[model samples]
Target: MPRFQYRAADANHRIVKGQIEALHETDLVTQLDRLGLTLVRASVVTKHKRAVKSLTQQELINFLFQMEMLMRAGVPILTALGDMRDTAASTEAQHLSAGLYERIQSGETLAAAMDKYPGIFSEVVVNLVSSGEVTGNLPEVLRELVRALKWQHEIAAQTKKMLMYPAFAMTVIGIVVVFMMMYVVPQLTTFLLSMEQGVPIQTRALIWVSDLFLKYWWALIALPPLLIAGVVALAQANPGVRHFLHFLVLRIPLFGEVLKKIILARLTDTFALMYGTGIPVLDGLGHCRKVSGNLVIQDAIGRVIERIASGTSISSSFAAERLFPVLVIRMLQVGESSGALDESLKNVSYFYTREINESIGKAQAMIQPIITVAMGLILGWIMFAVLSPIYDSLSKMKT
Candidate 1:
């Protein structure tokens, strides 16, 4: 699709200028007319180029929060959209509001219009809005959407924080090791070799490693990033490979359990939100399968869906997979028997969220001391290797 920059006059003869995507200029003009805008000028812009970037999570949250407030205050949806379009602080927000307003004016539903911008509005969001539209509960749904987005942002922030220290520690350790092998050890080893005494095994081994590193310094510097890029590209290109990588992450010690809990927390949180918004259980599960972010979980959800479709109970289907914890399975069973699955899912979400927080805190506390001990060992080896021969020389002089 080609994008077009256009200036037009609305039904009230107010001038509006924005960009929209269409098949051609004619189609762009038609879309403008449908928005009740009289096209004054239009020019096709290049594909894949936009004047504005995508909206950030915070920006989207603000937009939804404002929209909810306006609707709750008795303002019409179109009026609220138009006001937001004009007053938006960011170009991304302005463009989104304008596009959505025009689409709604052209007789498209809000959810349908939002579906056109998958980058900004995820499938989960669009489905929730569609349900809200159907039920005339758009304001309430939007509030819940804001809460969900905020919770997601917080979880992401915490996860990043949890990983930051270990990543930084490892990177610093790598740099120190490279510096020692390339510069420090070589200098010290030359002096040690100048002595009459034979070098100890530790010193000899250290020298061998230094020589290897100095000889292949370029490869040492380049291989890590290249390897990481290759792995990421391969994962993206192959579903099986990607799934395996996700599975591998979940099996890792200490960190893997935290990652699994995070995924489950997100899944249950989203499930509760969608189900609370009047989406069917099966439909909610289907949407969750797409957004699970873990192939293993997705496959598990897919199997659950199939089981439900084949007349199996939801709780039984979940338990049959054996991927989820016993607590989650029990909660689902209780929800199913009591006919309050949404509330049960909310409890599940809360449980996992609390677990993730505690697990992350403990992991962080444990990692710092572990990293310190590892660094101490490496430094100790280098010192002992470099100093042992010197000690031997002193003993010879005394003899």
Candidate 2:
């Protein structure tokens, strides 16, 4: 197929310049005329499909939200996309809308139009949209999608909230410790040595540590980050290592419990959305593996999927995994028994979301005070080590 660049005029004789694929200039004219525009001038653009930039999560969410709102207002899909293309603030958005508009205007379904830009839409999103198209409920599906994505965004923000302060406090504490060891402790040790007094054990230990810091300060600071990067790189390259890392991530005490809830909350919400859109439970579970974000969880879901495929109950399949909690299993049992899996999952999602928010709040509160006290203890030890020597010497002199 050949792509052509064309200049056309609509009914009002307004100029239209765009690219379309066709067999010849004759085909271009046919396409333009079909779109209610008469061709003025035409030239070939390209033969190959133009690659599009992958849209970010936020961009996809925004696009879906806009599309849902517009379509719900009775705007035709092509009209909405064309309007968006004309008024788009970014080249990415313009290109996206133009591509979709071209495809859709050329008789492709909206889901099929979106299929041309897989980088901008995930398989789950495409499938949901396809179901919507098939059921003639695209607007409702888009609305559900918007809600699920916003919920995911909120979950991500809450997770970051739990981590932000503790990370900042720890980094500050590390820098303070490094500064004291390299500058303050050494200066005090030198002063104490000049006084020609017997050094206390604490002071000697501090001086030794100061010497080590002075000699290997660069290694002390650089090694941690380097080691972390190496571990991450290695994990990425090796599936087993990546799996183990994810496993460890889910076992990290209170934080792990909170993270598990976050993952489950997202998983259940997405699953429920897909279910409500008329996608099969098995297919929905398959789509969910990608969103789990942890290899451990992904593999567990895979196992659950296999078990379900082998003629097991949904609740049994999930329970056999042993990774899902009592709450999830019990909810699944209820949903399965009552034939309301979507509703049960939604309830789980709601409960988990509330729990996640509360957990984040409690973790934030607990973490701040713990970090503050830990920092205080560290600084106190350094002060006691540096000052105790001077106090002992002064008392001996006075006696």
Candidate 3:
């Protein structure tokens, strides 16, 4: 189906315009007619779509919440979709709702249409919706999705906030340092040289640095992007290098700890969601392996899957891999014993969430002092270099 952008007037004669998807222009016109709207103009919207809007975590959560309410109130899928569509304020949400409506109208399942936008909806979401439709527990599953997405979004927001200040500080400091070396220090050094006296060692060193910077300023400007590109190219060309880079990322001091915890939380959250959908443990782990972005974890999952295939339990396999923290392994063991693995995975998610939050706070606190000290040291060195010659000239005159 293709999406069409259209302008129309409703019963109140108010103009409405938005993107809608359908099989053909006739199908869209029929949809508009059903809505009691007269289409004034419509055209197929086409672009080389490089990406499709996967239902956002927030939008999915909202959809779940609304669907739960509507389903509990005895509303059908089509009716619920329409209600949600008309009520959606954001263009993206409205567009998705419209797409969903058209999909249902065309006799497709919700999950089937959602499959078209993998970026918007994850595999876990598709599976959950499929299960909900099968077990007639769509309302309950939607409620769970709302809870899970909210938790994930909150953690993400905290992580971003924790990083923002240090990143900004580093950028500002870098700009100031570059400016001093390239412009300010060079101009001051010229005046000092004109004094017809030997410059101090500090001044001499500064002059040399300024000259070098002036000569290779373009190199300094181009180095960062070029280095980034080179690294990216190598990573893409070699799986070993890519894995090595990911491993290095996980080992970086403050930021690395937070990142690891965040990834763990996401993984555990997904596992818990799949488990809740009545998926078999081994099958859920298989899907999780496909979705895990970290190669190290994916390798560990490969090993774990092999063990599970050979009749070892989830906890035993996880323990053998040693990929999970002790607490996570213990939780899995308990869940296996109690047959409440979903709840256990949820616990693991919460534990990592707290860890990520604390790690972020600790990282933020450490980064501030470290960045401030670094900036101060760089500025102090430049100042000493620029002022040393002036001080030397003044001393000779006084003598």
Candidate 4:
């Protein structure tokens, strides 16, 4: 969609200027008319050139919290938005709030206005707000949103903590290996070759590797970033490649289990939140599919949706996919029979959350020792290769 900048006049003859996304000028005009404005001028704007920055999660959480408090205190929604816009600390927050205020003032529902900034407000947020709007429970929905956003932030932080150490260790190991192969090994091997004596096979192999590194060290330096970029680009452009990569990640021993737990926790939590908010199950599952972040899981959810549409019970639909654990399936069955599916999903979320935390701790414990041992073995190999020949030469001299 192309963005358009337009100057329009309200019914009271006040000029309004803003940017909106539309398929064409006609669409822009139609949208303006829908907002009760007469378009005076319109021009297509380049989206990339504008570089609109989105608000951070914390900023959005604060905005929601403030809005909830204000609304609870009987402040009007428009007034609350305007105050938030004026008092926002960051430019991104101010931009979002001001844009939202203008749109709301133009008679758009809060959800409809928020739908424009998909980067900041997710489908879940938009749908939940729309539901709240329909149910006359905007303040309560806003509070729930605040809690959900905070939980998401915390989960992200925990995941980072779980992965950071392994990433850092691997980076350090790569640097050390590069340094040895490029510089240290070359110097030592050159000295050994100058000795004019037969070298051991291990020493010869080390020298060959060192020479290769010295000859094409640039490739070593460049390949990692290029490979990473290529993989990311391919993942974004090709769904099959992305799905394969996600599948690979999910099969990666201890780490894979942790990642699965994290994803499951998030999925269940989202499903619970949506279902509890008066959204229908199929609609909630559709939203979950979009936000699942894993193609495999999304596909499974899609299958579940199809099954449910064919008149299968919710639990039976979920069980047909066989992607979920037995416990999850059983809980769903229980929830279905008891008319507390949302509560059951919430319990599933909590179960996965606890599992993720413990798995992360155990993984970190195991990984640290494994990394240490691997590093020790690499150093030991280099030392043995360098020293063994010297000892051999000493033995020859003694003989």
In the range 177-271, model 2's lDDT, one tens digit per residue, is 88999888877776888876888888888889999999988898799899999999999899999999998998986699899888878888889
Per-residue CA lDDT of model 4 for 1-399, tens digit only, reads 457899999999999999976545775776688689999998888644233377788888998899899998999997787677656788677667767776787799999999999888888999999999999998998998898789889878887887898899988998898888887987798678766568989888888888888888889779989999999999999988999999998999878888878887888898998898899999999999998888888899999999998899998998888877898899999999999998999888888878888988899889999999999898788888788888887888899
TM-score against truth, every candidate = 0.86, 0.86, 0.83, 0.84
How many times do residue backbones clash in model 4? 0
Candidate 1, after superposition: displacement of residue 6 in Å? 16
At residue 329, candidate 3 shows an lDDT of: 94
- Deviating ranges (above 4 Å) for candidate 4: 1-52, 194-197
Q: Model-by-model lDDT, in order? A: 0.89, 0.85, 0.82, 0.85
Residue 30 alpha-carbon offset, candidate 1, angstroms = 23
Badly placed stretches (over 4 Å) of model 1 are 1-53
- Candidate 1 local lDDT, residue 203: 89
lDDT of 3: 0.82
Q: Note the residue pairs that clash in candidate 2.
A: none
